[model samples]
Target: MTNSPTPDQPRVIATDAALAFLAEIREDHPDILFHQSGGCCDGSTPMCYPASEYRVGETDVKLGEIGGVPFYISGSQYAVWAHTQLIIDVVPGRGGMFSLDNGRERRFLTRSRLFDGGEACPLPLARG
Candidate 1:
């Protein structure tokens, strides 16, 4: 059950491969969140966790939903990346040790492109 982005252009989206992988992951853990982790040797990589397992922090910002799961990042990171659209893709590799994609042999990756002129900028802060 993928959720479409609202009237505001989405800040994040998933590739078909990523959506397929996310669907498989959803079978076991029905509720999850994709968090864009902060920097540190790929700590910036996105991590998937069961919704109940991880708590969203104060500065966490909900970028948007991809494949029905809400995607998030720190407000500071959002500030740095607000002009880009996050593209989630699936790749062959071990996922983050703490991310649900771990042990699956395929992991989620983030790619981005700067929004073209005329697209919306600066979405509401701290939206989750």
Candidate 2:
């Protein structure tokens, strides 16, 4: 299930081009996942990995699904980005170093817009 802001607004969504690219990647790795990087360098890019190779942390926040794949952000990062909606789009450049899309000429980019009053996603990330 996708995590939408305020129960109805999507927290993250993919552009048509990005969705097409995701389809290409899905052909190879049927089960894929995405984690928005919050590191000091190159953190804007969304890193994708096969479901078998990566692990979702207990503190990670599931922003939502883009192109039918789960997208997550770290709890700390989510705290800083709570007022915005993550827009997953395609850009011409290298993807995250370890991401499945590394070699592809196109990469998944994160663009965000701040939520207006009453539009912010305040859902507490459920943890085990």
TM-score of each: 0.90, 0.92
Question: How do the residues 67-98 of candidate 2 rate in per-residue lDDT, one tens digit apiece?
Answer: 88999899999889888888889989888889
Q: Which residue segments of model 2 deviate by more than 4 Å?
A: 1-5
Model 1 lowest lDDT segment of ten? 1-10
Residue by residue across 66-114, what tens digits does model 1's lDDT show? 9889999988888889888899998899999899999999999999887
Against the reference, the lDDT scores of all candidates come to: 0.87, 0.86
Q: Give the top-scoring candidate (lDDT).
A: 1
